[model samples]
Target: MKTIKSILGILVAALFVNTAIAGTPSAKKATTLAVDTKESKIHWLAKKVTGQHEGTIAISSGSLITSGAKVTGGSFVIDMKSIVCTDITDAEYNKKFIGHITTGDFFEVEKFPTTTFKITKVAGSNITGDLTLHGVTKSITFPAKITVAGGKTTATASIPVDRTEFNVRYGSKKFFESIGDKAIDDVFTLDVTLVAGK
Candidate 1:
């Protein structure tokens, strides 16, 4: 009788241990994280024969969904009015540069004050998303590095977008002839870094 009681107690303890293990949260549980706008930014560059202009753009709001370290999906809002020119050191020239780029000659910020990128699919570090700018949306694929640690997640990606696709003619070489060195490259790159906290 004593031996049977001891055996039952051991089995009960083992059952409780298994139950606890099963109740624990999974590491790969689907998680939706808000994009940390304060800690995220997009760097933009457009090249011309004279050189190039680079600036930082602010993220208005966004979110990232993840499973473990894999970025399942995400979307970001770019604040076009927040565009600033870092190449032009002079304050006046920088302001002029900003003003011109925000006009119809470039991004047309007044008409479309914001741009967005929404992820449709993701494979490892490669992400396919729809980017909307100037009210035109197109699918774009890019490579990104995503990592999760200490309950925080970060992602870095670079995307090159063609201005002509979004009807941004401006000084694009594709739309006009004889523009020569005055023409701007149709492709502009956006280097993005995003952070999200659980």
Candidate 2:
């Protein structure tokens, strides 16, 4: 009788242990990686009637949340004050052009010194995010080529942004009908490359 009771107790204890283990939830395999600001790049292209201006901007800080070999989420901050005009060879012209775009007429870097983007959803190659520019936030979607390997992630995308959506209407023909040749295209393009790792 004692042997039977001992066997039953052991069986009950094993059953309880199995139940407890089964009830525990599994942890998610997700990790957050810091973006390498110096290694990442953001290139901007703005067009006018006569010609176009292209330049590069600096990213201040950012991070990417990853799961396995995929980019699950991420956010990035752009330093608006770091805008540069590379196409203009003349230093004076480049400085003046940079100054003009950073003024209240355009990006208004004095009031809105930074732009930001936060990922809201990711579906295959498309990434939808909230882009905050010049104090206005709007949802934008762009296709990115993302690769995760060797403890690092690299993502590249060309994002088209409408200047008028963010209240940047200085030389936009969409805002002023009679602006004529002086009008700049409302849509500008930003080519972004982001590199991040643990």
Q: Which number leads on lDDT?
A: 2
RMSD of model 1 against the true structure: 5.1
At residue 186, give the lDDT of candidate 1.
89
Q: List the residue pairs that clash in candidate 1.
A: none
Model 1 segments more than 4 A misplaced: 1-27
Model 1 per-residue lDDT at 118: 97
TM-score of model 2 vs. true structure: 0.86
Off by over 4 Å in 2: 1-28
Q: Write the per-residue lDDT of candidate 2 for residues 78-126, one digit (tens) a residue.
A: 9999998889999998888888999978999989999999999999999
lDDT of 1 by residue, 1-198 (tens): 999999999999999999999999877888899999999989998898889989899999999998877889889999998998887999988888888989978889999999999999997679999999999999999999987887889999899999899999999777788899898898999999999986
Q: In candidate 2, how many Å is residue 138 off?
A: 0.3
- Each prediction's whole-model lDDT (CA): 0.91, 0.94
